[model samples]
Target: MIGIRSVVFDVGETLLDDTREWMAWADWLGVPSHTMSALVGAVVAQGRDNADALRLIRPGLDVAAERRAREAAGRGEQISEADLYPDVRPALAELRRRGLWVGIAGNQTARAAELLRALALPVDAVATSGEWSVAKPAPEFFARLIEWAPGAPEEIVYVGDHPANDIHPAKVAGLRAVLLRRGPLGYLAAEDPAATAAADWRVDSLADLPGLLSPR
Candidate 1:
């Protein structure tokens, strides 16, 4: 991982575990947690968007509208330091200690951004798809990322749990990729050679990153 100057992490399933979010959705939909988990797994297996799980439960549902309504009803998106993975704090702090510019960016909402900033993690930047109006796996997203990044694409490493969203697209956009094998997609990628192969490095936790980025 030599030549790396910046490390940008994906939010969901990367720095954040997301278990609480899913459970909240299940409660909102009045469905069992196991049902929600099953639907999420089904969509992942079918390679459909995570939103598809909700669509399956309530066809023709306007997810965004529902989110706004949920918020108005006193229950909406919530991100807390408790949602963060155990490795997130120390990992990002260590990256900064190593003089690498650390950031957390991915397909997340404005509220998520605000909540994440509240955590005050040791990172140089924090942004999301909602803040940028461009989602990942899209060239525009990575283009914006490269524009915001402090170094060349090759010098910035984008880490996430999903191969399609993080590894392949980042690599196609000229940034190095790191796959963190923790979430659903990460377990799925474990069975796909191309997924693992696309990442410059595969790690079980963010703790592995500082050492990888260390000068060799």
Candidate 2:
């Protein structure tokens, strides 16, 4: 197997637990879980990427919108950083220790940095659609990540939970893509054959990441 020298991670399902965020959104919108869940499934079925999903939820869900949603739902506000995936920090630290350049590519607002800080999984670079105003599944995001890292795409692996957003675009950009199986939304990818085929690798937990990415 070719050795991977760098790694990029998808923020939502890959590195962070986004269920709380979605539930919070549902509460804010006064939509029931069942209702919002259906919408989420529909959004994914349409192959709408994460950015598209966010746009579909709220045309402009900026930091202010996020706060308002939480407050309206009677849920105390918390930064995105407060909701990181379990074992993410340790996994990231291990990857860095193994001499890999680490980056994060996601469709999040500037709050991504805050979340990373909260999770304590600081990476070498971060490329976000919110910052660039472009989303993934589009080659533009991956292309920008390549430019930001200035590393050979083959040497970099991108990890995400979504088949369309992470695996497809990462592979097209010449980067290996690892699918993380976590969160309720990822259940669809687990059951879908086509989605399963898109990933270069798959792990049930982020704790498996160090072993998966370690040079063989």
TM-scores for every predicted model:
0.97, 0.79
Weakest ten-residue segment in model 2 by summed lDDT: 47-56
Cα lDDT for residue 208, candidate 1? 93
Q: Report the lDDT of model 1 for residue 183.
A: 87
The top-ranked prediction according to lDDT is 1
Estimate, for each residue in 1-216, the C-alpha lDDT of model 1 and write its tens digit.
378878899999998888898898899999999999999999988888998999989999898898898899999988887888999999999989888988889998888899999989999999999999999989999999998978899998999988888899999999999999988998898788999889999999899999899521
| CA lDDT of each prediction against the hidden true structure | 0.90, 0.73
Clashes of each: 0, 1
Best by TM-score: 1
Tell me how many residue pairs clash in candidate 1: 0
- Candidate 2, residue 62: the lDDT equals 73
Candidate 2: misplaced stretches above 4 Å?
45-77, 80-82
The C-alpha RMSD of each candidate to the native structure, in angstroms, is 1.2, 3.9
